[model samples]
Each structure stands twice: as C-alpha cells, then as structure tokens.
Target: MRRLTLLVLLATAAPAHALDLTATVLANKTAYIPPQCYTRTEDAQGAVHNPCQTCHTLPRSPNFVSDPDLQQDYAIPGPALENPWTNLFVDRRAAVAATDAEEIRDWVRADNYLGADGRPVLAARLDRLPPEWDANGDGAWAGYRPDASFAFDDAGFDHGPDGRMTGWRAFAYVPLPGTFWPTNGSADDVLIRLPEAYRQTSDGSENLAVYKANLAITEALINRADVVIEPMDEGRLGVDLDRDGSLGTATRVVFAFAPLEGVTMHWAGRAGTLGPKVAPLAAGLYPLGTEFLHSVRYLDPRPEGVTMAPRMKELRYMKKTSWQSYAELEEGALAEKKEDADFPDRPKQFFGSAEAGIPNGMGWRLQGFIEDAAGDLRPQSFEETVFCMGCHGSIGTTDDSTFAFPRKISGPGAFRDGWYHWTQKGLAGTPDLVRADGQGDYAHYLRTNHAGDEFRSNTEVISAWLAQGDLTPEKAVALQADIAPLITPSPERAIALDAAYRMIVREQSFVKGRDATIAPQDETVWRRVEQDAPTGIAEPADPWFYRLKR
Candidate 1:
C-alpha cells in the first residue's frame, strides 16, 4: 500500500514530457555498488544498507565539459533539411542538487543510459555530457543499453551449435536526424564519388560505371547538404508507431540530407538502366539509381519476441560485432577478418575478414554502396566503414549509432526534433549551412506534442501494443483486413500502406521454425564472380553494361 502511494506521487509529479521513472527503483541497488566497497549503514536487523552516493560522489555542475574520450567526434549541429520544429528544453549542466543527483543515479541503475564504452554512463559523469550527448534535455542520459541486469535472449540468427547472438539486441544509434539514412534496398538518393580504379571499362566495368554515375548526384547533394533521410516503419505492421517492427527484425536506416542552398538532383545520362524515370524534389530532377552518403549494414539475428520503445523496462542495445558494411563495403570472410582487430578502423579500399565472436559491445559498423552510371549498384571502397563513422561518431548519438529511425513521427515527434527547432532559433544569425536558422512545418507540432522521453524510439509505442497481447498473426491479418477499408485511394498513400501491411503479415511468423537468413550482401559479390570466373557465365556484367561493352 505504501509503495503504491509513492508510485502514484512519482507519476503525478513527473512532467508530461518527462520519462516514466517507475523503472528507476533499484531491485538490488547494493549489487550495482557493493556496500562493502562504499559507505554503508547497519540496520537493527543486522543488514548493511549502502546508498548510491558512496561511489557516485563525483559532482557534475553546469560549467563542466564532457571529456573527448567519452564522446564521438562527428559533425555537430547536424543536417536539418525537413520536419516540424519545437521549443524543447536544452540542459547540459551537471547535477548539483541532491534530488537531481539522486534521480540521475536511478537512470544508471535502470540501464537507461550509456557512455562511449557502451556501459551506462555513471551518474557522476552525466554532468560532463555535452548537450548533444543528452539532446532531449532529460535529467538521465540517453542510450538505452542492455547490461547483465537487463539480460535478453541471445539464441537467434540460426547460428551453428557453438554460435549464439550474444550481442544482437544491444541496439544504439547516432541521433542525427538532419543527415538521414534510407532503408536498405529502398529508393536511394544519396550518392558517392567513385575512385578512378572503379571507373575503368573491363570484364566487370559496366556496373562500376553505372554506380559511378549514380554516385555523382549523391556526391553533389551531400556536398550541398540537400538530402533528407526518412524512416521506413512509421504507422505500419499493425502498429501505429514507427520502428515497431524494425527494432526487432531486419536492419535498415535512411538519411535524408536537406541542403541550405536548394539542390538540383537528377538522373544520369544512362537513366534507362535505372528504369527510364525522373523524379524531382525540393529543386532537383532525380534520375534512377541515386544513392546516399553511406550505409551501416549489420548481420542482424532477427530474434523473435524482442521489442523496444522509449522508457520500457526490457530495453536492448545492438552489439558492435554484428556490424558490417557496403559502397565502401569490403568483401566478406576476408573483410570480416581484417575488421576483427581493426574495427571502425581498417585500411581503405582493402577487403579482408570479419569478427567471429560475441562482441563486448556495439561498433555500429556498416557496409556502404553507391550506384553506377548504368544505374547499377556497386560496393564502395573497402574502407567505407569510415564514411559512416565520419557523421555518426558524434558524442551521445548512441541509439543504433546511425542517424536514422525506422519511421518519422513515431511518437509525438522523435528525439531532438524540438531541440533542432530551438537550436535554429538560438543560432538565427549564424552563417552555417547545415544548421541554418529556419522553421519546418512540424515546428508547431513539436511545441505542442512530444514523446516525453529522450531515450525513446518507435519501440515505446510497440511496447504498449505488445502489453495488450494483440500481436498474433491472426490478429495481424484481421487488422490488415480492417485497415484495407480505411486506406485512402491515392497511389503514394496506398503504396506506403500496402508496404506496411505486407511487412507485418510477413513477419508474424519469424521464429515459428525456420533458418534465419543473413542480411542482403552488397553488389560486389557479383563483381568478384564476374571478374574472376567470367568464362562460367554468359555475361560478364549487367545486360546494360554488357551492351555498353559491345
């Protein structure tokens, strides 16, 4: 009865935008900081009572600066090309008041925070965090980590008897929404610059050439900061929130770059290979096969019964070892081997081996790719891992360590949307291209509605849905039938709606009994085969490239 009253008071006292602190209670607070190791008090029952303050004596004040070692060094004030803005709070000060300090310590105990090493950033360290590190201005830090106290199932990805996905659920990302990443195998708009070695005409030249051309446009937009990466899992798969299906299965990220100076995107001369279509956006005519800055690919285990959202108790993090790449996607086996020791750091343009063990944490590695002139995709130089790190390495952007969410507007507004607006207003006179002062259409929405927690994603919405136990396949099919009538008739709307339904129906039976497949490999596999074993195949390159060779 006493506990219930305290909980009620805590709930009511919490700000509407504040995170639900129910999970803040320490089940075994002494386990986190051993009583013998710190100061303690003995009760009449002879039990020792140790408070959190014993080891958490480091005080974070308003003037403290975050240590460089604790943060990723990526582009600050990230690219903001779209969205509605809001007037969210921005506090980077260290906790001085006893109440603030105690509340922050609770975040550490709940596995709801993290630092550069993937462990929960100790409460003492919260004050040193940069505002970007705690973008949502919440008292506790961001980065929903999975520690021993928050253990999860690691039997996934159909590994051999000795293999287990020990770190599959430790998901994290860089919270840079301005620079967006697109879902894998979806419509790509960001492109890259191809090195001379890949542009030559030879046995495997056609696809490379096509990718080169496609990347030209991507390069143009990236340099101009005009790309916009949208989310793929919004209001889909029998769920109203984004990332409901995405956080559990499959690895996809989209980054949309918005340029300060309007961009002029268009297809290359060989647009026929990309399907003979032209689409324009903002101020550019986009041809087929356009690409983005880089891609972060991982061998996802696609585990069953795992779900996440903001402020949920059963949160998980994506482990670093499961990460892989493309564009700059090096070859498998060999690339993986090379990357094992030199993860997030490898020789550029070299293909080598990968890691083969349960990683200590998440590396957020990705296989990047770009399109060719003939509208074909090509693997990036082997060193493409750095391309992804260049932007995502920012301090405190740890939710998947990539700057993308499964869908936009999953909750009131996703993380930092409000902060972005506030920052825009704060820097109204700055000449910065990426962080230009302006307002998006959703700024008003951001001001009025908010997800209420910084460490939130689409997973929060799904958690509520799952709590109701209405996620069965039969229910999914029924919901699909129910939604069919409500779906509008427009082609664009219908396509999105249909995609969502299709994904939900397909994923309903992920773990019922089947071998899990690896995520899609980069296009370089074919290039290697064509280059090495040309005689075994009738064509050495894509049909378009083969014709070009003729």
Candidate 2:
C-alpha cells in the first residue's frame, strides 16, 4: 500500500507535460512566419523562383514590380505618360523600347519567362492572384500554391458551422493604431469595447488600406502587450452603454496576442511614409516574435437603445470560442484533470476553447491564455477560456464588426480636436483625460499625424474617380476642395468617406484589358483603367462594395 501511494505522489508531482514556458519564452520560440513570395537564382539561365514570401515582396517596391493581371503586353503611351512595364523597371528610357519593357514585364508577371538555365521566374504579385495558384504547371491555378492558405489560417482555424469568417476574410478584424495597450499602467490605457447585439448602420465607409497603414504605424510606436485581464473600473474606463450618463454594473477586460498581418500598403504608384517603417521578416511580412495583442471587455446585462453612445443590448452574456493555430494541442491535455490544483495555468485551459469548433477560436488564434498586462504568463480557469468575440465576432462594428475600423484614427495624436464632440457633455464618472481632440481642433489631429498623409492621398485620388468616373488634373483639384472641410471636424468620418469613395474607384479598375497595351481609340478606356485603380488590383469585395457597410 505504501509503495502504491509513492507512485501516485510521483505522478502527481510531475509537472504538466512540457508546458513550462514563460510568456516571453513561448512568444520567442513559436515564431509566426507570414506568407510571402521569394526568388532564388542558381544559374544564369535558371528560372526565377517564387514561394509565398517571394510573391508578397515584389509589390513592396516604391515602383510597380509586378502586375496583378500578369499583363506583359506593352501599354500605349498616353498624355499622362504612365509606365507600361509590368516589372519594376519603371524608367522607360532604360528599355530598348517601351514594348520591350512591356514584354519583359509580362514574362516576369506570368512566372513563365525562362532564365538562361530554364527554371521558372518567381511571380511578383499576390494581391491579384487568387488564394491558390498552380506553380507546377498542372494547368490549374489552384488556391495559393498548396491550398490558398493564409498566414494566420495556414495553421488551420475553426469558426464552427454558423460562423464563416476565416482565411483572408478574417483579416478584416486586425487591430488598428492607438489600440495597443501601453505598459506604463498610466493614462494611455487601451479602451475596451463591448459587443453590440444589433448593428445600427450599414455604412461600410472605413478604408481598409488606410486602416492597415495606421496599424503598421502603431506597431512601430508600441510593440509590447500587458496581457492581464483587468476588472473594468466604472469610474476609470467604463463607457455609458445606454448613453444614460452611468457606467455599466460590471465590465471585465481581456488582452491577448496575435500576429501582425501585412503592415504597409504597397500600391503601384503610391508613395511610402516618411515616418519609421516596420522592417519585413524573411517571409516578407511581420517577423516572428513580433506580436499584436487584442483587447476585449465583457459587460453584464447589456443596455438597450442607442443614443449616439455605444450600446450593448442583451440579457444573457456572450463569449468567444477558442482559436488555435494549425498546430494541434499537446498530447495528454484532454486527460489532465480540470480539478488539479494547477489547472488554471494548465496548457489544456490555455489552448482549449469554451465553445468548441467556433469560428472565433480557429482562424484568429483566440485561444485563452493567462497573463498580466505586462505579459507575465499566468494560469486561467477553464471557465475563463472563452475566445474573443467583442471585436472579431461582434455584429455592429463598421470594419466587419472589428474595432480595427473605428480605432484606426482613434489612437494617440490622431484627432486634432479631441473626441469630445462624439460623446455627450458632462457624462458622469468620466475622468479628465488628456487627448489630441480635447482642444476641439479635430483638424489639428488630422493635419499633423502621419495618417493624414495617407488619408489625403487616398481622398485626392479616390474622390476624383468617384466624382467623375475617371481621373483628370481638373477633377482631382475639385474633389480635394469638397473633402477638405470634412477632414478636420471629424477625421474618422473623413476616413470613412475616403474608404467609401475608394471602393467605387476600385470596382471599375479591374475590368479586363485594364492594363494591356492599347491603341489611341482605347485611350479613354485606358485612362479609365488608370483612374479606376485608386487602390490596388485586388477587390476587397466580390461584387465591389456589396454589403460593404454591413
């Protein structure tokens, strides 16, 4: 009997199977390699090679490197004098002739041009290619080389049957600037938003590219996360859910880590920012160990009726499912006893989902983890292992129900006038927090911040196309005037307008032969094509802007 007791103690004393990792250590070892294309040349005649990393890198150049449509045909010179080459060779004078450059661009774009040794040249563009493509010449451009896999979802995600958000679609929820939780434990705390039961509007006005740019910029400012779940202090950071000038009874906030998606916008003609840029990893995306943390809060007994204030309406509480990478949970997790003394920090609870097979847990890596605001790893209860639905799974946010859209410009130094106008006057329990918009100079925030450059550039180019269906020097000037007043009073509103206008221009840019060489008679069509591409080649929407605001 004594011998049997000794064996039980030995088994119990042994630490949970191999999960003894600190938050920092775990973050360092499990580096996420973003998907990109690459080129490798062995011989003078070898074919150019492109893996995922290689494909995503070419577009990052200041000049156009590859065409999304794979257009190799030379473009006819027009009065505007656009570069017709599909490759990065933008200086037409360097080519033997314009047509020569165009032909070379085509060969490189198609990934079919043979080098001296006869290997395939790497394809340069991914935004234009479908999720899957045929690199092996099987006559099928199946979804991205192996399976149209996305960097976030390549590890396999689960959204359950009812939730269809995954793959590239799930990227819409990636966090934005100003939302990164600062570690100072001071006033720069990131706000926690509750999930709205019903959506109030259908205005899909948030420009995704602009949103993405802000996120990239913010990633440069603050990269660490305080992952601890803090109890919401009604007097400190709570919002009046019903705009009734009162805080909710209880609010629990959570912050977790995720991989940063594509950071900068890499359009053919757009200029990059003068501000600092995040260096790309070998995979051409954010490097491994680079982390993006998501913040969510839960409010009990959601309020009803919206009165210009954010509202949460529901009697019952809602929580998100767990998300996991393609990597499976470590063995022996399931059999581990939940009642074990150390169960809170156990790997099973950290990786398991409260709601099994739900969409939130699968693609977004919304697994439950225990950590403080400083990212100090801790143990969490199985009950607390719910996934985050406040942003990714919410039903009312403008950017596909994610806070990425609204917070795009809501971050520090974003608003010149401050956010006072958006809320009611003298809300009870509100603190005297200093913010960019506090001075009532929204324009101050709009003109000074780096995002202003992106917004103005998008507005100047996209607004012209929306107003005239084509771009002209005169049309461009006129549209800029119309958008100027709206920019300062409300930067977020202006950004939403910019997003909406760009959507229209993007729809018209993808018509067939939009990039092909053409005769003078086709000049109008070509000009339309040029104007059409106020954004990049990829259609953010299927029927361009359909259900955009929903």
Candidate 3:
C-alpha cells in the first residue's frame, strides 16, 4: 500500500540533523501561475479550464512559461545556486495572500511571489477567486488551484502507435515532519512547490485538499537561530549549520531524479524540424512537434488517463516550452534527454545506447543522495536513505523471488536485483560487490520492502549479524523507533496539492522499470538570467559555504 509506506521510510538511517531548512529552503523560489487547463481538444471539452487568467495565473498547459529566446535557459528560477543565503526566495514576490508562504513560493521560481508588507516582492494580479477563501465552505480558492471544471484524463496515454502516452506515474515528497534534504547527490537542500490545477471531479484526480504548510523557522532567522545535528547512517540524514549563515563547512544539497539512468523524453516532430527524422536528437536543438501542443514548455503533461486526442499538429507556442520558471532550476541543466538512463556506473559497466520509446514524465529528482562531508557519510556520495531509490530503485525490476538476472546480467539485467551494486567494466567482480543474496541487512534491504518477492543479499545476514555480536543500543533504539512513525511524511504530507500527490510508498512487483519515469531531456536551451527570483521579503546572506559543525 502506497509503496509499503515508501519502503518503511526507506529503512530509516537518517541520523544527521540540524534542520531549520530556512522556511523550507526559502520555499524554493515559489511563484507558479498555472491556474488551469486540461483540454481534450475536440474543440476543448473534458473538464478543468482557466483559459488564461486575465494577466496569467494558469492557463498554458504543459506548464507554460515561455518567451525565453533564452533567459538563463528559460529562467523563472530553475538551475539555482548563485547563493545569497540560498538566494532567499530567488527574486521573491507574488503574495496577494494564499498562505503556507504562498504554497512555498508557488513551488519556487514559477515567477517568485510575496509582496504585500511581507517583504521580498514582485507579483501583481487580483481579479476574482480571492474574495477571502470562503472558509469551510465549498467555493474554494484559498489558493491551491483547480477550480474551472477539472478534467484530467489523457485517454489511454495516446500514441497513435508508439509516439506518446502510455501514461500513469506518481511520486510525491513534500512530507515535512522535520523536512530536510541533501544527503549527498547534491541538489542541496532541494525545494520545489507545484500546486494549482486540481478541482477536477469528473474522475480526474486532485479535486483539492492535502493540507499542512508550516514555514516558520522564526520566519527564517536573522537572530534567534540555534541548531546542531549530524548522525548519518541507518540509511541517512544529516546537517550541521547551513540554517542560513554559519558560513561554509559541511555545505551540502542533493537530488537526482532517475526514471532509469539519465533523461531524454524526445519527440521533436513538426515545425521546421531540426532532427525529427524520427529520433537521434542532440545537435543544434529543435524538435518538439506541434510545438508540443501549447508550445514546448519543459514539464506540463498531466493526463494520467482518458483524454487523449491531439496527435498530429497544432503549433501555436510563441512561448511556454517545458514551461519555464522554477527560476529555470537556478540557471541550467535541463536539455531534457531523460538524463540518458544512468544506472551502470561501476566503471562504465558495459557501455550504453538502448533508448527507443515511451517516456515523458517522472523525473523524481533522482530520489536521494547528497553529502556535505565533514565526517562519516559521503564515501563517494549517497546518503538520505537513497531518497526512496528515486522511484523505488529505478524500476528495471529485481528483489528476485525466483525470476533472476545474474547468469551474468542480461536483458534489463534479468529484471534487475540486489538493489544494484555490480562492478566489472574491466573485470571487477570478486568482492567488487555484485550481490543479491549475500544474506541481508543492507541497512534493512528494500525493493519496495521485498514485494517483488524473492530478494537475497542481506550482506550475509548483516555479516552474520555483525559476527554474532548481540547488537543492542537498546536494540538499535528500539529498531529505529518502530520504523520512525511508520514512514514519516505526514503533516497532511505538508499540504500543497494542485493535482496528483503519489502515495505508493511501497510496491514491488519487480519494478525494474515496468512503470518507468525520471524523464528530462527533450532539447531546448538559451539561458542568460542575472537576478530576480526572490519574492518573499528577501535580504539575508552569510553562507561563505555551509556551516554549523564546530
């Protein structure tokens, strides 16, 4: 159920602590204006609609944010990391009022918001939908999104054949009980807030209401901010300063979405095409067929099921491709090539080249791995309980109950297993790792909690239970406090819904990529942005580079 509550919270190992997370990492540059749009295109008729909010709040599907011949790759705040105490809300602004700090700055960089006396400001709209949140009523609009009708069904994931839509993906993570990211893959204390199109009821998904949005670390601290934590291992969790102004030391931030390896949701189809001969993209860029519906904006496709129709040509995107503005992720790194399907790193593990079809959503931000290295964790880098294996361990299937893959790694590596460790590019297998049934204890073995059923590598039963050592720090603190609240993430999942929330915390029918995700590469780049992403009362800088350990 819900991914076995996300593998029992991915077998708890997060000991490190020191989280103020500066109002959830300055609510990650919040400001996302996508008030609505779901079109079936039969002239438009399925449900949900906003047609475009007078001055732009949400009505450009595919997540629209265009007009960037290139403003730092599409800027709105995406590549981020120029630093100003984490650039404090980037260009900040967009607060007419709709709380939880404007849904964490509209999930950051959608445009930056928070003006009205709160401080760091910039956004300007105000027509209807804000008469003061009907309270307990039904009129709804306290500001989360999805009012106009609400239709979410991309119809059997279209494809006209093998071109698009096989759809169905979910993976949510804003679970804040003590929220904090960055074990060491390095998106560094990541923060992103999307929520605004969901009112749907005609059988779509998120009609609304998830609940929980705190943000008050003394508002973010300029004075009363004291913190300390760093334990690492049990899986992972860490921190020691960076609450904004301890100034450099363990400095860390990480996140890496893996639908399976690298990224690349390709399709370039129509519009004077550059490489649409069918596939093989990368060169000069250009290939988003029909400008990709509403125009190439990076991430805006929510059909989940049923609506499918528009499959040939429509081209009308003077803007909105990959729909720019999470401040464009800080400033670069999303040419969208599905990141190239990554998993084989043991030394290059036997080479690449195997792409083909179906993909276009689910970049779970590579689930988890971030290390600031001041002490223990950070061996090569991979902390934070592997962040739920980015999608229950990148599917490709494993945890083998019987169906195997070690005859020497075939097919998707025989449907994957041993949670991936391999090692033989130039012949590296001996103790080089390739485990699957060594015994068990990989901090508590996973694979959606072994649901794919037949798993084996318990590292020789945790090395014969640490060599019959009768381990007990109160039995490892009561077996990690009974699996830490069962799988943390409740506060109503830190409230903030726009449409899809993803609950599969655990499911392992050999997920070795059966339902894949982790996509990103589509192709489109220009980038130039300099400043302007803050919005929520900016003004706070000190981090010479992460601190709080001494």
- Model 2 TM-score is 0.20
Q: Candidate 1, 271: how far from true, in Å?
A: 45
lDDT against the true structure, per candidate, is 0.22, 0.22, 0.18
* lDDT-better candidate, 1 vs 3: 1
In order of lDDT, best first, we have 1, 2, 3
lDDT of 2: 0.22
Model 3 scores a C-alpha lDDT of 0.18
lDDT of 3 by residue, 449-539 (tens): 2211011111222233233423333433333223222221122222211111111111111111111111110111112223332212122
Tens-place lDDT digits, model 1, residues 167-258? 11111122221111111101111112232222223233434323333333332232222222233222121111112233322112222334
Q: What is the C-alpha RMSD of each candidate to the true structure, in Å?
A: 26.9, 27.2, 27.5
Candidates arranged by TM-score, highest first: 2, 1, 3
Name the TM-score of candidate 1: 0.19
Give candidate 2's root-mean-square deviation (CA, Å).
Answer: 27.2
Model 2, range 1-550, lDDT digits (tens) per residue?
A: 4454344334334332233212222211111111001011111333221111111111221112222221112121122223221111112121112222222222212212222333212122222332222223344332211111111222122122234322111111111211111100000112211111110111323232222222332232222212111123333222221223455432221112233653322210011212123222111122211222222211111122111211111011122222222122211122232332244222212343221212332123332322222212222222222223323331111221223322322232322111222222111222112222232121222222212221122233224233443334443344322322222213222222222211212222111111111112221112222312222222211110112233
State which candidate, 1 or 3, has the greater TM-score.
Answer: 1
